[model samples]
Target: MTLHPQSRSERDPETHRAISYRTTGSGHGAIVRLMSPSDLGHLIKPFVFLDLFEGESSFIKGMPMHPHSGIATVTVITEGNLRFEDADSGTGMIDYGGVEWMRAGGGVWHGKEMSPGTSKRIQGFQLWIALPPALENASVDSQYLESGAMPEAGPARVILGAYQGVQSPVRAPDGMNYLLVTLRAGESWSYVPPKDHESLWLSVSRGTLAAPGLVDAGEMAIFEPGNDAVTLTALQQDAVFVIGSATPHPYELALGNYSVHTNPQALRAGEEKIAEIGVRLREYLRQPNDSASVPVFR
Candidate 1:
């Protein structure tokens, strides 16, 4: 179903999608909550939460271990780098075009897997997708793909879905596409969604753009719901942003503090699993964490 579509503007609707809603979102410290499950999420469904974060002065060295279930998180680094270490992936830097995908299926506790990199300034977006019923309680799966490992299509990196016959290495679920794109000054690019994927939205991280209407840096805009392609011009400066389109999630968003499930029954089961996992996680954290970083604790 199309959501809060705006009245057609005079601009060529065939070339660019009109904006239905836009927000800079609320900011706390260096992180801006562009979209959350409780706000502006239902309209975007599977695409539930988004955060535009930049650590200017000093990035947090380590984030405390947290739990999540019934969702998958995709992290993209836009400005700087973050250090990632895992026993399977070893050590690497996640810079622009790099990605980290974590499916917190069933239940998982993680955080220290990534520490501060050499860059003093860091910026990126973390997006959470509500899991489908079958995969909601599946086993945890994580992938840390370096910039070189990710596929690209013209000006965009296929972050989590196939584009122009190129596919991302990360094994994300179907019916959604996430892209990280950069347009040089005066450059133009268009994004055509996959079949049946109606939900679409985007957030700018740097420079200004005109998807026919000005979408300045640091703003998130929800497109009038449809499958029409959107062409973006980078105005007079280079523009960098992340765009997402997906099939609307059909389940109710049953949420807990750190989890999202399809129904109340699933949420209760997920919460119980995380609570049990937390007890063991406290013990796991007490041990020396000096070896390789554990990317996921299921």
Candidate 2:
């Protein structure tokens, strides 16, 4: 298998952090949050942090025009449409239950909105995958993959990675896997990590999930590989979660809003690079990409 377990020196645990965000957009799309990936360094490796946001009003909105570098960001929406427009890359738009992936090779800038209509409920997850050192200084670029375009693996909907021989079109510079899994009530599923990958982390979104043990909603758990595989079962009527695991990589991490890096200097450079790109995106801030775009219009 392309995914194999790493040695003791390699096997690492996933560290979970609280969902914290800053208010960014105007009206209702303003909360901008960062998941601390650098807090754990890079042992389990490819994954940096998991950010969850649910906008209740226009004041607590989504992110606005911002830059990212040395990493990839996967935005998966569960409720409400999210409008996305990037000046550094091309334009993108995605609707309810959509997913937008951007590989900020060097750097890229983007803005997102909450549900444009009156439903008012906007729920989603934004994940960060650290870029390899080679691409840390490259020019920024992005690509969008609709939610429907993502492959399904068993009970799990793959948004940015692969599972059970099924794969997602959203490729990552790092050998990483990001999966969104939803299991029906009383349903049980087993996740066998790719041999090259060692650590597995799961975050519960709704309902209850059980591994060898039970994990309730709003909780995060880390599983160590080499012990066969970890199994998850929905304990309630329905449950959903995001699982991420990948091959270990040797890299440093420095994280700031909208970006992740291997070094502090790189982080500072990324900020400056995006600030420069922000000037370009500002021109189109008022314009909205149509529904055809991969970045959703919330």
Candidate 3:
């Protein structure tokens, strides 16, 4: 059956008018930046920086450690799996539908927490969220939830927020919803945004979709600002994608090398904390006796 077709009402044309902006981000390697703070991020704050990544075990295992602060990173696995071995977080495999949420509050260094899993090829998306002022410099927290722990509302796995009364296990911020949805060939679905959620966007990881218009794999599209529902139809093969909607972030973004803050003072504080933690991170990783792969220094 057709979901929310545009014929609902004459006054609903603009609300369900497909998309207004789209992009296939530029990159030469196994990863693509679908949205960044410099580009689509300005249009959608809080929800900033999105990466679509796919790489082999060798590449995934060799990822260098990195540091961040004043923001949180959400990693959703779309295919294969990654192994997380740490004394604190324990050991487990994050496969399709699994999500890892790391709040780089105050400051922290990571990247080695996850190594290549049983799958030779792993693919997923990493999203960076600019935190509110109160949480920007708060304590660091991390959550690793596997597929079975995730909840679904229809075809969508609630990744970061509530949908149709189903709430994700990831304790993300309020005012935003992120979902990972899969549709069989020729299936149609409708997404109704929550109250006051005006920012809307989606990125396709596989196959094609018609929000009444074509959105091919590897491309991201932005819906025109409104609190309305969008109808999506899988065109050819199975469709896998992530969608997000939120209330606009109200603060100016103060950018740093690996941090985003509400203002210059916050940025400076976060960077300072990150730098201090980086020194300890290097020492921990270089130790011959330390077997802990996932180390959090703040």
Candidate 4:
């Protein structure tokens, strides 16, 4: 579908209005950066950096081990599947609605934790959220949850926060809400933001949605800050997408090539921790028999 900007006059005043919009940009490999720290991330704060990717399972096998700190990554699979292996979680398959959450607290290196599953091709999103000060330097924690483990409220799957009294199993921080939703053609859904949630945006995986304004596939729409409710309607074909809302992250972002922290001191500490962990990771890989390790970005 042809993608273009939507005029203000075209939006319905009673529903949420699109203040800004972004289309995913091409990236180095089989991934696209939907949002990043250098771009719209500043406006969204805690909700920073989003990558949408799709490729054969073999494509992911090429990703090298990397390290991260001061942020948490959430991986959501919308199509196909992935095999997750970790000493703690053992081996399991994550298909549609499945999530892999990794809090790169102090520091950690990963890349081998997940491999291709039964599906030949897999499609999903990886979202990076800046951690709050208290948790940024804590020990790393990870979880792999299957589709059945996530709770559903109406057409939406509660991915990271509470919705309609259903809370997600993921131990995410407060003041944010993320949901995975699917709408059949001609179906409509309305979202009422929590009293404190001021930042809101959505990206569609497939089909078209009229969030009162036409949002084509792969396009992201950022709404004006407010508590006003938003309504969306699927145009043609079934629509699958993710929506997020959060209170502003109340700190400055000290950015690194692979990390984000609230301040420079914290950033430095996180990097130091990552360096220490890298040593252990390399040694572990050297003698690993069947241990599962998560992919780490440099």
lDDT of all predictions: 0.87, 0.62, 0.85, 0.85
Positional deviation of residue 189's Cα in model 3 after best superposition, in angstroms: 0.6
lDDT value, residue 73 of candidate 4:
94
Against the true structure, what is each candidate's TM-score?
0.93, 0.74, 0.93, 0.93
Model 1 alpha-carbon miss at residue 234, Å: 0.3
lDDT by residue for model 3 (108-212), tens: 888878888899988889999999999999888898888999999999999998999998889788989999999999999999999789999898999999886
Find the 10 residues in a row with the least total lDDT in model 4.
289-298
Clashes of each: 0, 35, 0, 10
Stretches of candidate 1 off by over 4 Å are 1-16, 287-295
Candidate 3 — worst ten consecutive residues by lDDT sum? 1-10
Candidate 2, after superposition: displacement of residue 249 in Å?
2.6
Per-residue lDDT tens digits for candidate 4, residues 1-298, read 1223456776666665564555655566678778887777887879888888887877878878888899999999999999988877778999999999999988888877888999999888898999999999998899999999999999998999898999999989988999999999999999888988988989888899987777877777778778877889999799999999999899989999889999999999999988888887677667845634544423
**TM-score (C-alpha, index-matched) for candidate 2:** 0.74
Better of 1 and 2 by TM-score: 1
Task: Tell me the lDDT of model 3 at 107.
Answer: 88
Q: Give the number of the best model, judged by lDDT.
A: 1
Tens digits of lDDT, candidate 1, 85-196: 8766778889999998999988988887888788889999999999999999888889898899988899999998788999888889998899999999999998999868
Of candidate 2, the 10-residue stretch with the lowest lDDT total is: 17-26
